[model samples]
Target chain A: MMDGSMALPFWLDALIALLLLGGALVALLGSIGLARMPDFYMRLHGPTKASTLGVGATLLGSMIWFGVGHEGLSVQEILITVFLFATAPVSAHMMARAALHRRVACRERTHGEPWDEMDRLPGYAESSSSSDSQR
Target chain B: MTATVLPIALALFSLSLLLNLYRLLRGPDIIDRILGLDTLNVNAIAVIVLGGIYMDSSLIFEAALLIALMGFVGTVAMTKYLVRGDVIE
Candidate 1:
């Protein structure tokens, strides 16, 4: 079909490109963390913190596209950015705690006993102090 | 027109989503799956924004908002379950 619609300005297009590129890079990093990080506790830090930022960047890019090209403010993307920011951390915290609990349990089974926090705390402190002295 | 630009952005976003999917599938631990799932939700929201751009309709924005809401609540619920092993408690 023949076209009469106004062309998007160069700046607007550049903004969109920047958004996608940034978003993709964020995702790539999260995936890398998922692959490279060792153990559950260590791995938990990567995607929840870093990738949330990445998605926000990408969403902001999309918001620019919609706002400049289509109508007024892209409120939906704004809302999404807000929601993602709020929940990503909460979820990661829960999962990490669960993983930690599971790890603690797993260790107990292997050792044929559970560690009491009260009993272990002083021993842990003394050993830590001794190790620090040796260092 | 924005139409031409929309597709390229959508395609790139889709590729990101697929990459997240691959991570989800290959995750060696439960935390990886949770991370992958979070990425997927973020990508879904991105797609909704892209949809609005592609169609030049503000209506798609509502869908994006809903996705954002659902994704957050769902992630929170899943995380709670993982920790407490109970939805209410």
Candidate 2:
């Protein structure tokens, strides 16, 4: 089955290639940011946004490739894309909150974090450890 | 062109995965590790989808979607547990 974009037009194939390559590069940048960033909040920006966008672009490319070249409109790719778009920020927000609750260290320039955050949490105690939550 | 580009793209994503693994292993703190794991999940999904495209099979889309949902759920669950001592009340 020659359903790949090659069976389509050269221009269409180029577009697919661009999309996949851009997505991959963006994802690589995000992971580089993740591995190299100095602060937790700084690190938060990497995977949550850039990585999500990277994956989104790739999925979009695949969606078009499959939709046109292969089967007719594979909804699963779109579902994954939208679901990831919706969830990335939510998870990022929750992770930030968790980091704050656990009082994870921030970079020196980070501002607005309350030093007296011990009482900020409703159930701070009765837990295992902030460094690593109990599994 | 896609013949050449596909493998290149796959390699880039795998390198990204390696960076994420480095972060997960060498993260200074727990949140960083969690972030690493989350990024790993996202990249892994892309790799799976890319692999599907390479194989010219749409069947793996199901696996990609499943990973997407599970990744979100796992991230949320871990964050929730960290935010509060309990996952469910």
Candidate 3:
């Protein structure tokens, strides 16, 4: 299965290689930041941004590689790209809202709480019912 | 060069998955774990696409697309449940 794909020119191959390497490394860095960040809010920052850009770059490379081939521009991967860009922020927002609703612990340096923001949410209710606290 | 880099890229992505696993396992709170899971879903798409390229097959991208849709829905559902104590209300 590995053999028989058409050959790519030198510069194109190099570009694809660069994209793959850089994307992979950025993804790893983001996951590392996700694991090591001090607060749950802080932890949310890295992976959301990293995974989108990292995967976007990698998919761009894939698109270019397959686009130049015999099938003439494989258009399907763009669906994944658009889907990711559209959803990353939505999920990040949802997860952030979840954190605030639950009043997840934050480090001392975390500035003002979004307690007001949480309170203003349409269905916001205090975490009094959530008795399980790691806080 | 493409040949050399593909396996290295694959290895790097695998390592990234491991780090996401660490956060998923050890997060101090539920949101962090959910974040880990969300990030894990996003990164897994990249891995599948890369594998598709290496295998010279385009069939697996359907799986990647399925993953993207489900991941978003799952994240939203869990977060909604967390906030409102219900998924559908």
Candidate 4:
């Protein structure tokens, strides 16, 4: 079994510890925000922004730990990291769109017109109007 | 020292998982629930990775990879359904 003797150097171990701690802390905070935030959109901000970074840091720490301890470099953890980073924003955007389509209420302090009006703004295509009405 | 730290980190991650579970249960809207589930998926992946570290196994890394793939697909599919009122049309 692997033990402290098999661990990386002092500084490297410290860095790994810091990464794990920081990642978990950020992820915990994101989950806390999801639980505590006032509205759906506000809650959406937490996991998408913070948790992505948290998972990335944790994966980095894992890569470093395994790379140093094993015979060769470790690259598999990078797949999860890249997959998460690429997909997080996309999922967040889809969730926000879904929330808007469902007419989920936003906090009163939130400014500007609802998404329906902004649909006319540059990128949303005219064809989406049919789907908008279906909601 | 490194051996000791792993369990502490694991406990902290478990706490986060509980927090996510609370959000998932308490959601007043479907989208909110979906968001909670998505966050839960990500946190679960993190937990699995930490588990791999603790056990010093490469096998768990593949589990993490699978979770990442399946979770993203599930979230996207659910969101698409919500937006279009149909999964495939």
- Report the C-alpha lDDT of model 2 over B1-89, residue by residue, as the tens digit: 77678899999999999999999999988888888998998999999989988888888888988988998899888888877666885
Across residues A19-75, which tens digit of lDDT does each residue of candidate 4 receive? 888898888888888889999988998999888888888888888888885533446
Residue range with the least summed lDDT across 10 consecutive positions in model 1 chain A:
A106-115
Between candidates 2 and 4, the DockQ winner: 4
Best by DockQ: 4
Q: Per-residue lDDT for A117 in model 3?
A: 66
> Residue-wise lDDT of candidate 3 within A50-72, one digit each (tens)?
87889888998888767877345
**Rank by TM-score (best first):** 4, 3, 2, 1
lDDT of 1 by residue, A1-135 (tens): 113125667676666677767675676576567556655555566667767776787777766765664566766667777777877777776676555544433322244333344236657657544644664
User: How high a TM-score does candidate 1 get?
Assistant: 0.71
Off by over 4 Å in 2: A1-4, A111-135
* C-alpha TM-score for every candidate: 0.71, 0.88, 0.89, 0.91
Against the true structure, candidate 2 reaches a TM-score of 0.88
A1-135, model 2: which lDDT tens digit per residue?
Answer: 334554778888888889999999999999999989888878888888889989988988888788874766777888888888998889898888778777788777766663345555566543435534544
Relative to the real complex, the DockQ score for model 3 comes to 0.62
TM-score of chain A of 4: 0.84
Model 2 Cα interface RMS deviation (Å): 2.7
Badly placed stretches (over 4 Å) of model 1 are: A1-7, A104-135, B1-8
Query: Which fraction of the native contacts appears in each prediction?
Result: 0.45, 0.82, 0.82, 0.70
Colliding residue pairs in candidate 3: none
